[model samples]
Target: MTDQQTVTYGIDGMTCDHCVMSVDEAFRELPGVTDVRVDLVAGGRSTATVTSTGPLDHDAVDAAIDEAGYTLVAR
Candidate 1:
């Protein structure tokens, strides 16, 4: 079995439960992503923890965040 790894990213513009859901769904679609958790902070930076079978693609993650209408600031 592949070893699972976790990555944390700082998100911008997440202010509610809906924002959490959007970010969660976006990361979940990435290849090998096993789980996603977001700590939503209103009007401030939030965080997303992503678990995957291995390292994920940075561009793909960025695109997913952009598609979800949020910005991935740092990893």
Candidate 2:
């Protein structure tokens, strides 16, 4: 990616460690994703900063996040 671009997602419904694990695992499976971090505090809002090797499609990212049972807030 260009200078390590970071994409943050406002995730919802992340209630515990399991939520963190699931979200982390799902994002890690993506092709260009390099790292994923999630925060389950504040009524289940996670900021996942995906460091990709190249540009990422927001739709695809959103889909992955949604598939993990979380709603992604547009930043």
RMSD of each: 0.8, 1.9
Error of 1 at 13 (Å): 0.9
Give the number of the best model, judged by TM-score. 1
Tens-place lDDT per residue, model 2, 1-75, is 155667777888788888889889888888788888777775756677777777788788788888988888876
Cα lDDT tens digits, model 1, 16-62, are 99999999999999999998989988999999999999999999999
Model 1 earns a TM-score of 0.95
Q: Each candidate's lDDT (Cα)?
A: 0.93, 0.80
Which pairs clash in the backbone of model 1?
none
TM-score of each: 0.95, 0.84
Pairs clashing in candidate 2?
1-53
lDDT of 1: 0.93
